[model samples]
Target chain A: MAEMRREWIVNAVLAMALLIVPLVALWINEPFYVTLATRVAILALAGVGLNLALGLGGMVSFGHAAYFGLGGYVAGIMAHHAFTGLPMWIGVTGSNQMLWIWLWAALLSGFLALIIGALSLRTSGIFFIMITLAFAQMIFYFTLSWPAYGGEDGLPIFVRNQFPGLNTMRPWDMFILSYGVLMLALVFFAMLRAARFGAALMAIRQNPDRAAAVGISPFGVKLAAFVLSGMITGLAGAMMADLTRFVSPAMIAWQMSGELIVIIILGGVGRLFGPVAGAAILVAFEVIFGGITEHWQFFLGLILLGVVLFARGGLIGLLAGRARHG
Target chain B: MSVALFAEQLLNGVQFGLMLFLMAAGLTLVFGVMGLINLAHGSLYMIGAFVCAAAAAAFGSFWLGLIAGLAAAAAAGALIELTVIRRLYDRDHLDQVLATFALILILSEGVRMIFGPFPLYLSVPDLLRGTVDLGITRYSLYRLALIGIGIAVAIGLWLLIAKTRLGIQIRAGESDREMIAALGVNIRWLYTVVFALGAALAGMAGALVGAIQSVQVGMGEPVLILAFVVIVIGGIGSIKGAMVGALLVGVIDTMGRFLLPRIFAAFLDPAQAMGVGAALASMLIYLLMALVLILRPRGLFPAHG
Candidate 1:
């Protein structure tokens, strides 16, 4: 119980730090820092999505990037059609509205998750990992070869899509939007974690047979979690596309999937704010180390190796002590 | 396509499958023996190609480079097993995946730091450079040699597994790690040897394929994913499964690419067909994998069952 309070405190600090850093940067006319904070928020949203499945549900999906990339394509393709005044298949014209884009991204990725999870959840252990990866690679290659929306070159959003009231052209506004979504997702994750469904999901993760014996269908719970997870990540992907104003197959690459897992592991698996902390640290490392040398990834790799080998609890775990449940 | 072209494509598929077998063999063996999924296996492949390319350039002998590449990969494999992977044996798959993924980032960036970002080219040995004539078609001698080598390795592996004492221990280890240890087998040494052997195979494939494809920083990744597909289809931890799966994936993939565009051209406009064909062709093996999963959830051969 004390550990829980400590974790709450840590989460509060992380949230404040995320918001305050960007606000400070905005005050000082440092738009670069605001952009970095936005990257952290957007990536944290994606990581939070994966955490629902990976941390709580014990499905180590190595293909969440499929949804992420799908979401990006959703945004990119929609924006492209809107700009060109062309109808998307069946005369469905595109909308420049971010809300519409987010809804479609969530729905499309959720549907995709249903299909992929249905197939992938049929296998467990290493087979699940590989199958998920294979599915993502299929999508990645498809995007690379399909030239309608710019193919390997990727499609650029010449202008950021519109929100109802804010001017997203300003870096601070974009950060606010991303951070707002991230906070909402975090709250949703917290509520879910405390819910009956979350308990069943975690129970299934701990032991499938036991979970099934208790009248909880492991597959159903896992599949639901996977779809929800994919939807959240997909929403992040759409937001990421808006933040970067571009969408490419690289977003769907296996490395991105790996990185998402990395973020979760770095922050502390299953912890509510793990993704937030993980994203902050990862982006900070990228900016700081990336400035120091061309081979910043080498150092990043070394740090990750250290974390996996010795400090398995990750940054959140390190600060708040081992997880209460664990 | 003409009969000659078709025949040539068949051989190409077979050759590609054989190369995939080399990678899948190591991957499956490691999984079967240690129950560890090493994502850095591809990095070892990259290491093999880089070392072979560098050595061949320095020594002016492809044979010397091949030997060096094999040794480097094996040694690196042994080193990592001793240092890092040794710890992950008891951990969950997620840790193993993350640790190995980190290894890739380190190795890739380390290689980039040392070799720079540009790709290095490896030339086929003089003895295997030219084309060889068969009745149906002429093919590159090097490619034909690769097929021959793949066959030889498969046979050699079969004999080692079936007839040799180490093979007995390996088969035992796969079924029961604790039992093998209790039987007085130096399980630790056996694991190192197995890992090194697998690494050598991956390295050899890298060195061999490096001749055809440029030796680059991220070359092993695509092949690694393909190997994952092969092993998943074959049945994890089964060598025979790896062979069958590798051949199936390689042939299907190559044929898909070769035939799909032309097939689509018949129905769709030429340009649209080319684009659609290329996209579908790229996804062909993954589709095959999904089909295999649907039919045999545990793969063609379930190692445990």
Candidate 2:
């Protein structure tokens, strides 16, 4: 009975935090914050993607930004080609449509993840970390040197990719769309965690040899988790590019990858809606600190240091206290 | 590309690889000895470059600047190892990664505060500024000198590890920590000294490269990535492997940048060809690494029994 109340209160708190505040802000016409909230929401969705792998599966990937950038590029490129009358490729119809672009982004990142994960998963521990990082760096350098899109300067989407009926140019509309995606991602995350595959992933994360002995192919499970994780992150990236209307090589940079990891650490590793809280904290810290000081990165660094050293189990973990039973 | 250009690129690649080796050697050693995955290794590289630049400007001598940079890097390494890193020695990789990432932030922002946003240039000595004419090709004499210095350092490290008593302790520490501590070997001092030595090597690499490139705020970042690649390729924790890995990566990267575009130009328009080809070629080494890892998860040369 007490457990029921605890769960109810937690859900209520999360719903109020995620939905109520944003809706109130919208009604109040404080749309400036709505835009920022959307930024946090989309990035949080991306964090959810990573949390599935890193948090639940104990896979520390340093290359998820490659998928993120690939997703962004997919959005930007399809839009650019549609605008400029350039075909995506020969013997196939191109799409500048947001939904279709997202579909492609998801598929492309999933495929890339299959390759990266396949190669990287051969080595465990630090080797896995380094290999992922190296592959991401390769992609980053390629994006920087390749001038077809924009090279180091990044490409801007002059108009948001068309989303059927929505007027995405309006701030509130974009925020609503981002909010919708965040809900979908959260639901997907919850459903995924409840699945048998999720159980296998958790089992493998706990002990790979044990999982393998129990007839779960640790390799396949990990690879599948990694690919799904990439696809989710890719979806977020596709939306983010359109949100900011810009895509650059920096999207795939190692620092961006590290930032995602940082965000996950800030929230809580495997908790539901943890990314939402983490993104909120990170973006809020950025907004407030950035407004006050030009060199807010110094302060952000200090805060990050404090959290890493002192916070222990992140916001959710601190608040919830190990969820009573793992 | 001309033969001279090919040779020159090869030389440039070697130079890059050696620098990577210097950075990776320390990182791999730390990993091997302590099981610590440090992200602040890059910050140490930045610290090295910053100190080199500052000291060079103040002292008006490149050699003195190099020495000062080495001193600063070593001191920073020793201090951090003694205070925070020592505590983390027994912790897991995740904690170490987080702490080191934090250190990178602190060091980067601290340096930026001290030395504004503007890049500080490290001028090569007038004595080593000229080009060496290799009959078919001419390259910077300073770069060739760098290669020579790198080789000497590699040999010096080899001797220090193979013949010296310190090497035995480092090896023992890698194998077993508690046993060594029980041996009354002053294990703490050994760890500190090894860390400081690693920092000095990284600093020397930074100081040397400072002459060729503009020493900027975030200059150490790219080199940090390359060093990671080197260590990954050259089997983590092996000094000899690091030397070999550095040269291979350096040459391949340089050659790819110089030649791949021309090769693609043969097939496509010059503009698109150069853009696509150069990008793909830059990624080739990483692709190679991926393939290697798939085949041999422990890298080309694993360093354990």
Candidate 3:
């Protein structure tokens, strides 16, 4: 119990640091730092979504970028139509309401995940990795050639979308909105992990055959987890689009998917606060290394290789101690 | 399409397929023998292209550049295997993926740093520069030569694998690594040799393809994705499957791009059809992969122990 408390304290301190660092920047008149913090929150949320599948469910999807991109496109397409005073479908005019946008993003991404997960879950291991990647590539090519939106050029929102009770155009307000969503996601993730479903998901991950022997359907559990994972990631994607006020095929690129995986591994897979720490570290590295050299990626690669080889547990593991499972 | 254009496209598809085969063959071999997912395999391809480009420019001979590229790639592959990859053999797939992915970032940026951001071009050799008059149409002599080279390599590989002691050891290692190691074969050296051989094939593909496309940093990523799709459709660790899957993907991709727009034009207004058809055509190979997976979860030609 004492150890658990310490871990919670660590989580609290990590989340508080995320909130405080940006607020301090706001106090000192550095709005750019606030935006960067918002990016961390949004990216962390995406990482959390992936961790549910990869860390808990043991489905290493190399195509979550498809969901992320889809969510971004949903936001972008909606905002585009709204700005142009056009209806999207059957007199449903586009609106910049964040709530409506999130709902649609979740619904669409959930649907896409259902279709994709049903097919992808049929295969396992390396085949699963390749299939997910191929599916993402399918979405990527489709977007690259689609002329209606911006195609390869991507679509941009001139102004940030309005959030209820917040003027999201302000950098601070945007940061708060993203940070709040991330908090909500973390709470939900905690609840899910404690739930019976989460146990079933983890069971499937450890041993699918054994899980089946215990009266659990591994496929159904994994599929549910995958869909839920995609939905959360889609919401993060929507927020990301809002943060940048732009959506492009780059969001769905395999590289983006890889980054999300990196985030999970960097923090500690299956740990609740993993994504938060991972996101903070990644953004810090990007800011610091990027400021120093153009070849930061080369160094980032070395760091990542060292982490994978020498440090099985990531930032969370290093700071909070090894995850129970780890 | 006219008969001549159809024949020309058919030939083009085969040529493209053969290029993909070179990549897929090596990838499958590594996967089968090592059980490692080396994402940096594509980076080796980029290295090959860069080396070939620089060598050709310096020596004024494509042939010499090709040999240099192959040798350099093999050496790089072996060096990395000794330094990094040897440690990863017993690790999980995620570790392998991340480590290799890191290798890609380092290699790509390293090459970019040295070569500068601008793309370098490789000119075709004089002997293989012009067109060959086919009965239906004129085709690039270089492309025909590439096809010829690909076929010769494939045959040579078959012979090497079927007729050599090393090939027997490789087969044994794949089926029963512990037993083979117990038999006193130097497993470490065998792994290095297989890795280098695979790297050499990727180099050959890169050097050959460089003459057609500009040699550039990050040139290998798209081809890498396509090769993944090929290997998936072919079966993860099967050579015969790679060859068949490559041809299927190549031909389907080419034919879809060529015919889908026309087919859509007949159904929808021309402009809309063009846009929609192009979008779908671009995704044809992935769609085929999805279909194949739905039907054969283990791939069409899954290799057995």
Q: Pick the candidate with the highest DockQ.
A: 1
Cα RMSD over interface residues, candidate 2: 1.4
Model 1, CA-based lDDT: 0.95
DockQ of prediction 1: 0.90
Residues A73-165, candidate 3, lDDT per residue (tens digit)? 999999998999988889889989899999999899989999889999998877788788888889999999999999999999887788889
TM-score for all models, in order of appearance: 0.99, 0.96, 0.98
lDDT of 1 by residue, A200-311 (tens): 9999988899999989999999999999999999999999999999999999999999999999999999999999999989999999999999899999999999999999
Which of 2 and 3 is ahead in TM-score?
3
Better of 1 and 3 by DockQ: 1
Q: Top model by TM-score, which number?
A: 1
lDDT of 3 by residue, B1-305 (tens): 78878877887888889989988888899889889887888888999999999999999999999999999899989998998999999997888888998999899999999989999999999999889899889888999998899899899888888889999988887788889999999999999999999889988899999999999988887788888999999888888899999899888888888889999999899989999999999999998888988898778899853
Q: Model 3 segments beyond 4 Å from truth? A: none
TM-score of chain A of each: 0.99, 0.95, 0.98
Q: In candidate 2, which residue ranges exceed 4 Å CA deviation?
A: A1-8, A91-93, A323-326
Q: Sorted on lDDT, highest at the top, how do the candidates line up?
A: 1, 3, 2
Which is the leading candidate under lDDT?
Answer: 1
Tens-digit lDDT track of model 1 for B37-64: 9899999999999999999999999999
The residue pairs found clashing in candidate 1 are none
